[model samples]
Target: MSQVRTKVILYNPKAVFYTMPLALIALASYLDKGIYDVKIIDGRLEKDPLMKILDSCEGAVCFAVSVLTGAPIKDALEMTIEVKKRFPELNIVWGGWHPSLFPLETLKETPVDVVVRGQGEIAFEQILTAIINGQSFQGIAGVSYKDKVTGEIVQNAERNMVDINSFPAFNYDFVPVNSYEKLSGRNQIDYIASQGCRFRCNFCADPFMYKRGWYGYAPTRIADELETLWDKYHFEHVHFQDETFFTIGARVEAIAEEFIKRKFRFSWFGTMRADQGSRLPDEVFAKCKASGLERVMIGLESGSQRMIDWMKKDIKIPQVYESAQKCLKHGIAINFSVIIGFPGETEADMDETIRVVTDLRKMSPEFRVSIFYFKPYPGNEIADALIADGYKMPQGIKEWSDFDYVVKGSPWIPEKKFREIENFKFFQRLAWSKPSLLKTPIQTLAKWRIKNKSYHLPIERKLIELIFDRQKLS
Candidate 1:
């Protein structure tokens, strides 16, 4: 009898932005040199992803789709349903943040045949082996799949975190060479130097996804990868896509030293917690900038200490200011991820946040602020509290897909308050673009005024918005 080869199709559903699908690329690279045949389809760039997937599914053993909790889930589910109709014999799998959090629920709610819970590379490879050998899917770690005969959902043991250097470098052949960039005219590529985070912020899903285990590649390994990309592909910027790039200060210093030794010139940016930056010395920031660290994003969730405590952020408000100042002094651009409309936040709390951000802008003209309305996602401490307080949760994959961090927020926030937040975001952008000596004084004075409990007065609020709003510059 002739031998039949094993084939699997991986799908990257549409996202809010078009970045490299590192997860799919990593999986493809893992399976590429093995017995299994792998193909990747990015829904964001495809003219017709469903048709492309259908065409690719010919003689394929399984179709796997990875997703987040938001709109991407809808995209993945839609693709899975249509693929199932056309090829019912094919195995359908779901992985990534959403499925890893709710494996059984995902298998019960969707048409997916299997759910690969955590660290999918090893589990997925094992799945291919089992299918090829005509063995049972039972005893596979980090997976949930329905039984063929009884059709009962079988949840397997959770998988441990994988070593950082276990996988090979990403195979860029599956994706377009020109498709990835951090910004227009910036030939940048995003790279994940590490996996997992150790923090347990009440509102974050990192704890659930990684189970508080942080792991990263060696400094030399990361630098080697970056230099190879820069030398070979002409990429000038490296966006470190770690959840918190500055988790280990010594490791980062080592990375900077490696880059310095190599004499590589590449501007880079990464996200970090405010406390992490505060713990680092001024020399570290200078060293990083000297080695091409252009920007660092800090999650300054709130300016109010009370709100910070409520969020269980552990970091104090003073630490945030100190970190911002250090970054500004070192000529490193700061991107602040601020959140408004927390469950119990008062108008006074909101005023404090605005005042603090205004001061941050004064410190650095290169400040980039991203303000988001707080949305309660599943499997988070804050989301559970919100649900307990009568907030409605999304029921199915379709409903979950509608949840977006940028455009949508908690329903408990009043329409008036919501409009103010919208207006604040509009003004914050303006203030950053047109910073001057005159505006700094006015902003400081306004901060003092708002701090004194005059925030609720209509005239006072409108005056604050007018002075800071970006539209005024136009």
Candidate 2:
């Protein structure tokens, strides 16, 4: 008898922007330890990802894909359908956010042979073992599959959440790390220090997936990984991809102290809720700043108190102000994540949000406000209400994949109001989002005008056009 080499293909579908595919890299590290031969394909970085997958499908045992909601789902299904057409005998497994929430729905709709729910480190390893030995899929946990003989769906027990602290470090050798830097135009990369979240906001999917479970790796281990990233790749800025970085305050302080003691000055940023921010001491922020903490992204959601209560955000308007003040006082940048066009939002509510953001913009040049139209995502409380109130959910994977969060999610909002929202986004971008040599003095004057109750004639649009043209010339 001769021995056969096991080969597997792992993929990350297209996302809003090109990022280093850490998920694929992490899975490969565990699978490639003299077990299986793994190949990674990041669609965002590839010119033709479909062709790459087709070319690599030579005697492969599994074709695994990770996907998100919205556009990425659509893109993943397209690739899956093509792969099946060419290699009918290969096993296609779907994992990650979308498939985890609706495992049966995904299995019925797409050509996927299996859906690996929850964290994939252990489940994926077992699946590979079964495939290599030609065993039955009866005992696998956290997986939904179709019976080969009966052709019926069989879902096993849900997988328990694993302690990610023990997971091996990502194998960056699978892909070129320098390619990501060229695309981003900076010395930046993303790293995950924690998993899960502690809140159940109605518009989010993290709660449903992790069941509000929060976990973090040890501070010393985090420091070790970050040092490796810097020493090996010269990475300067790290984007932490946790649901909320401050779920545990003591861990944050420990991580900060570890970085400070090691004399590592890698700039970093992460998200925290406004309610969480209100409890942190000023000394923590100062220490973190000294250790290269540059900014914190806080979800303000809405400026109207009534709207805030409606969303069950559980944070007071005064807390929002306090969070912003704390960051500004310590010289840390604040990125305000705002939302409008919820189910019962009014024009008055939108006006109040605009007024609040406009006031916050005057406090510091580093303050940033990003506005997005609400989307009724699957498995969220708001999505259920929207469906009950006569809103039609997407019929299948294709329809759901086309869902856009930037536009109105429901059809209840009038066309006129939708156009008004678009115009407001344009003006907000001109005032707060863009970089301009004329920003400091001009914005300072605009702040003075608003504070003095003097409504000056509008000239920003014309001035922005002139600036754009000058940049084009240069």
Candidate 3:
């Protein structure tokens, strides 16, 4: 007779987007099925997630949550606190971006027993083994735990980054792909072909988390797994969620060739840097296009050369244009994300960004530009510098819950400048958006306002906001 396998429940907190919980899935899939029974509960999909989680925790030995930096922290905390209230003996683990950044800090919370840092597959396995055998977490690398007897936090040495190829392929059966498709309004699957990032942008957290290390699955492995997934799910699209999917040009080329050779019938998208895109040969681009490359997202963080250099973007402004021209030539859609409101940025710098955005918008209607204010996310060079210069970060979970990277206003930006940037964003969206019968006139006026830089009376914006606010409340 087989021994009973202990249940391990993994929870993914509710998020704004419908993207599947790949992180939780990673932890779940890494566990050995013979000894551990892992059940993943995504808060986003449940009507009463807390009740469901409590129901599932009846016989579970461990309750692990994957948390991000912002609003998800609130939900995760609430759920974990409730779980601790009910199942005091169960080991509660917190892992992912927020916990990785603040391992010791996260342990101060009453619920979280252990915090897993970077690349948690191996570490998570060790943690589970230790918990099951009633062993000490003293020697577990990449883990921080509170001593049960002494009540002191112990942070182990950091673990080196591991190659993703060594891990088991993602088990899509763990998630309801059809439900995700319905939620996203696209018959697509989200996948991470690689882990960590090589580039060290000052505003990014990848460098501090991964120590500038990067690893990707072998192209053949990715192709084989994707083919199996396609056959199983019949999805039409694959969205690669890697930070820098095109880091190795030859690897990208090989992946594309595999996709083409397999005769896969799905389109795909990935993230790319301007420097990487510019350096790719024309033939490589052609191969990718032929292999169902539908769209690519490029982070052109700033337009001013000086700002780019200051941020350690390591790419020239000319490379941005070069990449754009290549994408246009290949008939691919491009989404260029730009950041504004950085520390020490001037009006002249904002103007340069606007000029570049306008030029990119004019390139092709298929090209899209997304503008956002720079939020000082921790675990980055800029955030470290700000901390050194006396910038106070959020103290605890409640404070961090209010941190919104996309919509939050930065302290460095004055009110007038903020309004100006907001108006520009509104007009820029309307001016380049696909027009309908009701929006053509508004689009024309928006274009005129953008051209003349005249945003004195934004009555339309106010009215639209009023309508949306009412709808949201209703």
Highest TM-score against the true fold, candidate = 3
**lDDT (10s digit) by residue, model 3, range 136-211:** 8998999999999998999899998888889999987788889999999899999999999999899998998899
Instruction: Please say which candidate is ahead in TM-score: 1 or 2.
Output: 2
For every model shown, what is its TM-score relative to the native structure?
A: 0.90, 0.91, 0.96
Per-residue lDDT of model 2, residues 1-474, tens digit only: 544558999999998766788777778887755668899988888999999999998789999999888899978999999999999889899889889988998989888988888788888988888878887677799989977778789999988888888788877888878888888777887888888887878888877887878778999999998898789888889888888997777788888999999999679998888887888888888888888899999998999989888888888888888888989998889889888888888878877887887777757758877777776888788988889988888878878888776675335456666665555544554445445776756555544554453434547646766668522311
Model 1: how far is 395 from its true place, Å? 0.7
Off by over 4 Å in 3: 435-441, 459-474
Kindly report which residue pairs in candidate 1 clash with one another.
Answer: 427-469, 430-470
List model 1 lDDT by residue over 1-474, tens digit each. Answer: 644557889999988766688888888888845466788898987889999999999999989998888889988989999999999988898889999888888888888888998688889888878877777679998888999789999988878988869888877776775765632346888789998888888989888878999989999999888877777778788878899999999998998889888988778898878888999988888889889999998998988989999988888989988898898789898888888888888878887888788778767667877778877778889888778978788887677888776655456567876766665664455445555786676455444443453334446446655666543441
lDDT for model 1 comes to 0.81
Using lDDT, rank the candidates from best to worst.
3, 1, 2
- Ten consecutive residues with minimal summed lDDT in candidate 3? 465-474
Residue 374 in candidate 3 has what lDDT?
87
Q: Assess each prediction's global lDDT (C-alpha) against the native.
A: 0.81, 0.81, 0.90
